[model samples]
Target: MDKQIIISIGREYGSGGHEIGRKIAKLLDIPFYDRNLLDEIADAKNVDAKKLEKYDEAPSRMFLSRTVRGFSNSPSVNIAEMQFDLLREKAAAGESFVIVGRCSEDLFKEVKGLFSVFILGDYETKLDRVMERRSLSAKEAALAIERHDRNRKAYHNHFCNGKWGDSRNYDMCINSSRLGVDGTVEYLKDYVDRFIKTL
Candidate 1:
């Protein structure tokens, strides 16, 4: 097997971003972590995984509220932190993995090996993808797009102090909807192959 690598994906809602990460991982024969990151965290903390998922990558808008938002007096936060700490370690330990959301890029900011990417798409394109993927009515898709974007932006801004879709925070940024999911994955794989050879 090839040496492990870490791919951290930051995506706009409905951008077909998560699947791109997964495809890369699958093709590369590595672990793909999105919800699993939280699951692992929840496991270590012995907290309800569902509850953490609800607040996962979500933040309250008010600055003060955001400060206290993830701060639970319970052992949950500690467990989550420990799980994340392990993730950071694993990425550096050369286990090529795909990570979606949860600020994995930011959390592993100082870690040595990572291909950080930010995924984006036009508003309508995102809405269309969301409708198709989530099997939601157009109206429901619209609501999901708006709500998810807002929550994600707020969450990334709150926790990572970075824009959700900003290229500066990422090594590469791609418009996935334009490329479509499979095309996007192939593009990324090719990019990574070339990138790794140079490294």
Candidate 2:
């Protein structure tokens, strides 16, 4: 851990990406950013936290228009810009942290010692996890998963130069279902330890 390590995780809905990121941060003794990023942005930018939450990880309404001018001031777009700026500032200051989502992999491309990962689970596994976690019925969970994945894909594709969940965009692409949450965390911890040495 001699060098600053920034781990950016892209994940599918209910893939335990947030949990894995937090665990990795804890194991590595670094900061973890997820929904908490919105709070930081809200406080720093003097914006409403709740409003940012509403637009979090969602594509701009005019994303389909193919014209940046149309959605330049949109809440989603503005919030994304604010988040990116804050993250860039952190990176430029040599902060070592783990961040989940927010297209962080793309944000940190120029950063040294960045280990980007993407996690995806089988659809059935994701559905079951979502149902239990959200206390939703099977049908509701299925719809929620579809909606979230769709929105995340749209958001990432619109904001990033690379496609979401694509292996080529990340240093590693893991199927969390194969190793489960704890196992996946353990595996990533070891991989990150090795990654740090090469830095």
Candidate 3:
């Protein structure tokens, strides 16, 4: 059997990365994991999905007093371990999936038959998408976007300890905002096809 292509996506804030994944999933008729994934993991583990939502697709650390951060007990390691366990179990199930964020690319590094994708876009395009989706004023949107990006960076770094958006870490990187969601999805479908043939 052909090994499943597990598309793990890392994206810039407001890059429409999530929507692109959803569209791709629908087109391929496969499952896509995002926030809803937190729900599944939570239920299976008897953990509160709501509590995980605090870190959902967002970073656990965006900004903190250096002093406070220094004092944080290493308790986060427990949560990290649980999430990692969940990721491994899911990957072993061998289902086609489009999984977003949580440093999934790094998490699945040793897993055979996986493809990692990174999605990004120009600042202005990302900002526009954020504004439209959140219905926030310019000032509000700008602040929120920056915050979200930082949070993801901090979150991914916390576990992966590598640079985000580094091309080598992913199989393909797309500018979804430039492709305008649907275009990006179609592009990814084509991209995945070529990738599958090579394997």
Q: What number of clashing residue pairs does each candidate have, in the order they appear?
A: 2, 0, 0
Best model number under TM-score: 2
**Ordering by lDDT:** 2, 1, 3
Clashes of 3: 0
Q: Report the C-alpha lDDT of model 3 over 25-118, residue by residue, as the tens digit.
A: 7787788887786687778879788877665544443244122543543334445556667777777887667788868899887766677888
Superposed Cα deviation of residue 70, candidate 2 (Å) = 11
Clashing pairs in 3: none
Candidate 1 has what TM-score? 0.84
Write candidate 2's Cα lDDT for 1-199 as tens digits.
4599999999999999999999999999999998898999889879789877998888888743333655465778877878888989988988999999989999998888899999999999999999999999999999999999999999999889999999999999999999999999999999999889888
Clashing pairs in 1: 4-96, 5-96
Stretches of candidate 2 exceeding 4 Å from the true structure: 63-71
Model 1, 1-199: lDDT tens digits are 4645678898888888887888898998888887777776667678778877655555653533322565654333344455567777776566777888877778877765678999998888898888888899989999998898888777677557677788888999888877788999999999888777755
TM-score of 3: 0.85
lDDT of each: 0.77, 0.91, 0.76
Q: What's the TM-score of each model vs. the native?
A: 0.84, 0.94, 0.85
Alpha carbon lDDT at 53, candidate 2: 93
Q: For candidate 2, report its TM-score.
A: 0.94
